[model samples]
Target chain A: MHSFESLSKDFAAFFQKSHFPDQPASLYQPADYFLGLGGKRVRPVCCLMGNELFDEILPDTWQVATAIELFHNFTLIHDDIMDKAPLRRGMATVHSRYGEPTALLAGDVMLVVAYDYLNKVRSEHFHRIIQLFNRTAREVCEGQQLDMNFEKSETVSLDAYIKMIELKTSVLLAASLKLGAILGGAGEGNLHHIYEFGRNLGIAFQVQDDYLDAFGDPDKFGKQVGGDIMANKKTFLLIKALESADPALKAELDALLQSNHPDKVEKVLAIFRACGVDEWAKTLKDQYLSAAFQHLDDIAVLSKRKEPLRSLANFLVQRDY
Target chain B: MHSFESLSKDFAAFFQKSHFPDQPASLYQPADYFLGLGGKRVRPVCCLMGNELFDEILPDTWQVATAIELFHNFTLIHDDIMDKAPLRRGMATVHSRYGEPTALLAGDVMLVVAYDYLNKVRSEHFHRIIQLFNRTAREVCEGQQLDMNFEKSETVSLDAYIKMIELKTSVLLAASLKLGAILGGAGEGNLHHIYEFGRNLGIAFQVQDDYLDAFGDPDKFGKQVGGDIMANKKTFLLIKALESADPALKAELDALLQSNHPDKVEKVLAIFRACGVDEWAKTLKDQYLSAAFQHLDDIAVLSKRKEPLRSLANFLVQRDY
Candidate 1:
C-alpha cells in the first residue's frame, strides 16, 4: 500500500495538472484561488487509500479523488460565506476576497465541475457513484442547516450534535472511501465495511477535535486551544457536561458558559474535569476509533493490505494538531 | 400534440404533488417558499413540450421537468442575492425574507435535490443527461460571472452582451428542451435541433424584452417601461444606438446616457429612434426568431407534431408583457 504522504503527493501532482477555463475571471478565478490554497487534502488521500486496499489504483480513482476534493473545497467556500469567516487556510476566504456573489458563483461552478468529473467515470460505476454523491451532498446541506438551526436553538442534545457532525463532516469522508472502493472493484460487503470504517473514524476525529480544543497544548494545537469554549460552541464536551452534571453544577456550568469572565476558559475546563466530561469524551473517542478499526478488520482483505488505512485511522485519531 | 396549456397544467400539478423534507426549516422552508412563489414555470413547460414532441410523454419527463424547475428556482435565489433585487414573482426575495445564509443554503440543497431527481433516470440515459446538464450548468455559471463582470465594465459590446445572456439564460432553456427530448428517446439529430430551437427562441425573447422595455405601452408591458433605461442597463437598444450613431449623435447619446436627467428615458428613446436602433432591434429579433423556426423546421418530427413548440415560440416572442 502507498504511504499517505505519497498518495497525497500523487493527488497534488494530479491536481496541479488539472486546468480550469480562464475566461470569466469573476467565477473561475475564485475557484482557482480556493483550490490552490493549501489544505490537508485528507478526503482525497482517504479515497486513494480505499482504492489501493482492494486493487491497484484505477484510472477512474484519480477522477473520483478530484471530484471529492473539488466538492470539499466547494463546501468550504460556501461555509466560509455562511460563517462570515475572514480567512481560510491562512488566506482571505473566497467570499471575503471576492464578493459573496462571486464566491457563491464560484462554489456553484465548483459543484457543477465536480459533477463534470464524476460524469467521466465508466458507465458501469456511474449510477452507484452518482447516487451516493447526490445523497451525501444533500446530507451535507442538511447538516449545515441543522448547525445553523442550533444557533437559534436554546437546547441541543448530545445525540443531535453527534448526528449533525456525522451528516456534515463524517458522511463525505465515508462517501469518499466508498467511491474509491467502488472504482477499485470492491464487492458490496467490502464496500459497506470500508464506508463504516471511514464514518466511524470521522466521528472519532471530530470528537478529538472537540477534546483538543479545550485541553490541547497551545504550542501543538495550531489554533487557540480554548476557542470553542470561548465561543460557547455546542461541542461534545459541553454537551456531555450539560448532560451529566447535577442540577447545581449544571447551573454553575451554564453560568460559567454564559459569563464574560476573563478566566472563562479555565472555569469551563474546571467544570468539565469536575463532571468528568473530558474522560467521557476520551472514552467516546476511543470507542469510535475502536469501532473504526473493527470495521477495517472486518473487510475481507489481508491484514497486511489494511496497514495503510489502519495507520491512517491511528494518525487521524491520535493527532495532536 | 398536447397544447402548451395542458402540458403546463400537468407540469404544475406534478410540482404541487412534489414534497420537500420539512425538517431544518431554515434550509428547506426557504426553498419551499421560493418555489411556491411561482414564476411562469417556463423551463419545465418547455421540457415537457420537448418530451411530447417526438414520443409519448414518459414518466421520467416529469422528473426531468421537476429537476429543471428546481434548478431554475435555485439559480433565481442566488441571482436575486447578486442582483440585490427586492422582489421575485411579486413576492419578497428569498434572501430578503430568510437571510442570505439561509437563502444560500436553500439554493445549495435545491441543487442537490435536482440531482436526486436526475439520478432516477434509467442508467441508459444517465450519462448523456448528466453530461449535458453539467455542461449547461457550467455555462450558466460562466455567464453569471460574465454578467457580474459587465456590471463593472464600462464598454460592453453588443456581441458580448448577447453571449452573456445566452450563457446566463438561453443555454438552460436549451438544455431543458434537450433533456426532455433525450428522455423522450430523441435521436441525436433531433436533440441538437430542438436545443438550437430553444437557444434562438431564448435570445429572441430577451431582445424583444429589451425592445419592449423602451417602446411598449406602459399599461400592456406589466413593468416600468423605462426601468432598464433609468438603470443605465446596457440593453440591445443602447448597444445598437452606441454602434450606429454618427460622431456628433454618438457624443450626444453618450452624454444623454451618462446624465441623471429626469427625461433620460425620453432622450435615450429619441436617440435610439434617430439612430434607427428600434428598427435594428426588431430586425435582429426577427432574424433570431427566424433562425429559431429554421431549427424547429429541421427537426425530423412531423410538422404537425411540432406545432405546439412552434406556437410556444411564437407566443414567447410576441408577448406584450
Candidate 2:
C-alpha cells in the first residue's frame, strides 16, 4: 500500500473540492472556510489504509473516506464552538471567523452530507455500517460529555481520565478503521480485531501527544508544546502524577500545578520528571501499544499483510507535530 | 384526541425521563433545564395531535413526538448563541448560564438524542421514518443558513423574506405533522396534504407572530411587544412597509430602520402603522391561513375526522394570546 499521508492528501483534495454544494451560498461559506483549513486527515486515511491492508476494493471508497473526514470536521466545528477555540489547524476556527450560528449550521450540514456519502455504499454491510455509524455517533457525544465533566472535577482518577480520552478522542479512529475494513469485505471477527488495534493504538497515540506537549521541541511541534501543563489540564501525566504522588510530594505537585508563575510549565514538567511520572506514562504507552499489536497479530491476516497497518500505527505514534 | 398542549407536555416529560441514565449528569442537564423552561411546545404537540387524529396505534409514537421537541430545543440553544440573546423563557439562556462551550456540547447531544428518539419507531414505518428524519434534519440546517444570510442583506425584498422565513421557521412544523401522519399510518396522498397544511400554517403562524409583535398589546403578549420592530428585524410588516413605501416614504422607512433611538421600537411601530403595514400583514396572514385550510379540505380523510385538527388551527391562529 502507498504511504497513508499521500493517500489522505489525495482524498483531502477530492473532498474539499466538493463540499456543501447544496447549501445557500453564504450559509455554506463557513463550512468551506473550515474545509480549506486542513488537518492531518488521520481518520479518513486510516480508513483507506485499513482497507488496503486487507484488499483493494472500490477506487471510490474515497467517498466513504470523505464521509469519515467530513464527520471529523463536523465534530471539530461544533467542538471548537464549545471549546472557545480561536484557531484550529493553524487557521481561524469557523465559529471564530463566521460566528457560532453559521458554524452550527455548517456542522449540521456536514453531518447530513456525511450520510449522503455513506448512502452510496453498495454492500450487504450497509445495514451493519449504519448501525455502527449511529452507535459511534452516540459514543462520540458521550465522550464529549465526559470530557466536559472532567473539567469540573477537582480530582480525576487515572482510569476515569483514560476512559474519557478513549471515548472522546479514540472511538472515531477505531470506527474509521472498522468502517474501511467492513467496506473491504472483511469478516466480523477480523474487523473487530482491526477496531481493537485502532482503539488501543489511538489511546497510546494520545498519551504520547500528552507526553510530547510537555517535552517536545516547540520548533518541531507546530503549536505550543506545554499547553496542557499551562492549562493544568488533566492529561495522562497529570492523572498519573496525582495518583502516584506521596503525601510529602503531593503538596509540591499541587503547588506547581496551582502556581501562577511565568515558569509554571517548566516547573510542572520538572516536578513530573522528578517524580518519575514521565517514566510511568511511557510504561503505560508501551502497554497500550503492546495490546494494540497483539490485536493486530490475532487477525487472520498474515504478518506481511499487516505491515502497512503497523506502519500507519508507528507513523501516528511517532509524529512530532 | 388530546389537547395539543397536553400531548406536548406528555411528550416533553417522557423525553426528559428517557434521556440519559445518570453519571456526569451535565450531558443531560441542559436538556432538562431547557425542557423545563418550556414554551407553547407548539411543534411536537402538533405532531402528537396529528397522530391522534388517526387511530391510537401505540405509545411509541410519543418517542417521535419527543424527538421533534428535542430537535426544536436543540435549535433554540444554538440559536440563542447566534442571536446573543441572554434570556429564554424568561430565564438565562444556555450559553449565558453554562457558557457557550457547554451549550454547544449540550446542543450537539440534543440533536443526536433527537435521532435516537426517531429511531424508536415501530418496525413497520421504520424505513420511511429514517428518510423523513434525514429530510427534516437537512432542511432545518438549510433554513438556518438562509436566516444567517438574511442578517447581511440590506434589501431583503418581500419575496426573499417570505422564502427565508418559510425555510427557517416552517419546515420543522411541517415535518413534524408529516412524520406523525406517516407513523399514524396515513396514506401518501393524505401525508402530502397534511404537510402542505402544516407548512402553509407554519408560514401563517410566523406572519401572525410578526403582526402581533407590532400591533398586539404588551400586557396581553408574554414577551416584549414590538420586539422585532425594536431590533429592525426583517418581518412581514417591515417587508410590506418597505415594499409599499413611496420614494419619500421609502427613504423615511429606511432611515427609521437604520435608527438607534431609545424609542426605536415605538418609532418603527408608528411608521409601520402610518404605512398601513399592519393591515397588509393581516392580509398576508389570511392568505396563508386560507391556503392552509384549503389543504386540510384536500386531505382524503373525512373532514369529520379532521374537525379536531381544525379546532387546533383555530386555537393557534384565532386566539389572542
Highest TM-score scorer = 1
Q: Give Cα distance to truth, residue B197, candidate 1, Å.
A: 1.6
Q: How high is the lDDT of residue A321 in model 1?
A: 36
DockQ for all models = 0.81, 0.48
Which portions of model 1 show Cα errors greater than 4 Å?
A246-253, A256-259, A319-321, B246-260, B319-321
For candidate 2, write residues A1-321 as lDDT tens digits.
667767866776777685666457666777888888888888888888778778884664666788888888999998887788998977899878987778888898788777667756666566566667666776787788788788888999988888888888788899988888887888889998999998999899988889888888888766698998888888999888888878777888898877878988877887788789888878888889889999999999768878778888888776323
lDDT string, candidate 1, B54-131, tens digits:
788888878878888888888999999989998987799999998888899899889888888887777368778888
lDDT of 2 by residue, B1-321 (tens): 666556656765765554654545676676678777877777877777667667673576777777788888888898888788899888999889887777877787777677666655654676566667667777777777777777778867888777777777888888888877887888878888899998888888988888888788778767788788777788888878888877887887788777877877877777787888887778878888899999999988767878767877887786333
- Interface RMSD computed for candidate 1 is what? 1.0
Model 1 chain A lowest lDDT segment of ten? A17-26
